[model samples]
Target: MPENIVIIGTSGAIGSAFTRRMSALHPASKIHAFSQSSTPTSEGNITYHPICYADEASIQDAASLAAETGPLDTVIVATGLLHEGDIRPEKSLKDLSAKKFMKIFEANTITPSLLAKHFIPKLNRDNKATFAAISARVGSISDNRLGGWYAYRASKAALNMILKNAALETARRNKNAVIIGLHPGTVDTDLSKPFQANVPSGKLFTPDFAATKMLKVLDSLSPQHSGKIFAWDGQEISP
Candidate 1:
């Protein structure tokens, strides 16, 4: 029997790319994709669930729907916020607004954390399971070289912590489950477009390329590797 997968943030570049890849790799598997927009036209093994990452009710509804279907074999959270209009100031910290920082946390950290809290319990314990969150490498305090994007960095860091803690808790009940935080590298998405100029040549990755690498990493993971943070290139990142 094929596995059941739940993909959050299905409208985003990386999320959409994963959906396409998974459709080809696991055609028999049921895929539940959550996005803020209405369902898009696609001929794949996908079920669209309209969900707003910023809304608590929408998150709960999505989780409840997943539970109703059956035990979730895998759940990949691709939701994140790089920029949120003028709410997130383009200027330095001197001009930063608390509201913008909080908004970033809501999207990047709180949203995924809430999903894990509600959905991990719905994962199948009879077999192996995986819960992966798309975190940014900038979230690693030890890896921080240049200082900028404070809100984005802080939010992702919080997400990493939450995923780690969730992994520990989930392990008690589902010993075979693997919870991980993944960084999709500098993909050519709206979130990374503005910052791509600084990226070295041949270092920037397309969403498809990043998704491929991420899937490889996910496939290689085991329960022993749970709670670890990994980059798209398959390298382990500091917490």
Candidate 2:
């Protein structure tokens, strides 16, 4: 089990669920949870920290603070963007715009890249370590049968490439380190709420279920698994 864990985007449903599950499962571990919201009163093994995901300086500061405790064994970036006010997934080529693409890419691609830049160096070299970002199966170019969500899909695809790059670079420093992308499988969160109607029966996962399954998958990973994307059922997705 990881002794020192860092979770970015802790204010999200899945992120918060991961924090709760990790704390319960590994009581002796120290979890540094970062989010955009102000730090809350910490309890047990979890400590909350505020962060601005759009700013590199804020990301670096959080990494520094988390590293002060010890070398990080795990860094999970749970940040992503799908829809917000005035911003929704594109339904057709006509809906595409530079503004939408930039906003989506900033949240899905750039944020994870910045996190890896600041946190990957802090991973423990002596033991197995993992850096994971939440990605989606729709990001898989080969699996994309319906290509409607242009920006979201492209952003995740780029994010997957970033994971591959980070994994290769980190290998030269720490051979035991693994950087991967995780597909949480349509969790019932605010990000997916508007699109949940089309989801098949029993396909929607609760935040807790997604968190537990992801932790199980993470526990099963090794350096050889780096640069790949894995689903909640532990199956690899083609990039």
Candidate 3:
């Protein structure tokens, strides 16, 4: 059967790239793209929906509508918020604030959790299914040796926990559903623009390149790999 894929945060760099990648990889797959901003017009097998990640009603509506087309085999939460107009990651303890911390948690942790809540029901139980969130390597508590961006790191860590919990629950009901957290590495997207100065040549990946690596990793997961965080190259990251 042809795949049915749902991509939340489709207006972002990585999300848009995944949209294109999926369309190219599976011409017959139904790709339902959602974003907080106005997405481009639907064309070919791709359909666009406006969504607010903070609003449960919008997410539920989008998932409900997307489910009408076909059973969902894959759902990717590509939403991320490294910084806004004034909300950048804290460099030290003095830079921390409750509001900024909450904002980070809202985007990194809550968004993907809510996506699973509404869309996991549509996952294919009788066959393979995937639920993946675009997480950062900084999210790994065991791997954090530099330690500076407190809020961003903590929120992603929380997101990792959420992914693990979701994976365990999904396995209890549907052994084939692989819920995971993914690190796209240092991709050349708006999210990484301000920080890309330090990235060495050949290290910064384009959105398309990152998306391709992620697709291959997602395709290779099995029941044993659920509840884990993985890098772009397919190695598992420590929690």
Candidate 4:
């Protein structure tokens, strides 16, 4: 079992669930939870820290602090952005804009990349370790049947490629390291709130349900599973 864990973006619905579920499942593990804004009051085996996704120094500092006790066993980046304030998914080519694309990519792609950059090196070298970022099934080019959400889709696709690259590079240093993406389906969270009306019955999962399933998937993966995307049901998503 993992002895040390780090979870980024624990302020969000899914991220907070991950923090809680992971703590329950691994009671002996030390969980270092980081949030972009609100600092959760530390309790039991879990401790909270403040982080800024837009700043690399903040990420680096958080990583250093988390790994100060020992090399990390698991690092889960549970952050994502679908829509906020004035930004929403594009429905067609005419809806795309440079500003929207940059904002989406910065949140969906760049922040996770920086997390991996700073945290991957903190992974335990002598044992199995996992680094996962929450991605979307729409990011799968082969799985895309609808042609909307260009910026979000492209950003996640780019994030997938970065994971693949990180997997390959990390394998060279630690053969047991696993780096991959996860698709949590249509979770009942703010991120999916706007598009839930079209979702089929029983397709919308609670944050706790998604968290449980994903933790199971993470537990079942091995080194060979690195560089791939897995859904909450443990099915591999084709790129």
lDDT by candidate, in order shown: 0.85, 0.94, 0.89, 0.95
Cα TM-score of candidate 3: 0.97
Full-model lDDT, candidate 2: 0.94
Q: Residue 160 CA error for candidate 3 (Å)? A: 0.4
Residue pairs whose backbone atoms clash in candidate 3: none
Encode model 3's per-residue lDDT on 1-239: one tens digit a residue: 43899988888899999999999989988989998886556799998888888789988898898889777899999998889888887888999999998888999888888998999888888888888999999998889998889999999999999989988888898988889999999998877889999999899999999999999999888878999999999999999
lDDT tens per residue, model 2, 1-239: 78999988889999999999999999999999999995765788999989998789999999999999999999999999999899999999999999999999999999899999999999999999999999999999999998899999999999999999989988987999999999999999999999999999999999999999999999999999999999998999999
**Which residue pairs in model 4 clash with each other?**
none
Least well predicted 10-residue stretch by lDDT in candidate 4: 35-44
Q: Between prediction 1 and prediction 4, which has the larger lDDT?
A: 4
TM-score against native, each model: 0.94, 0.98, 0.97, 0.98
Q: Runs in model 1 with CA error above 4 Å?
A: 40-42, 87-91
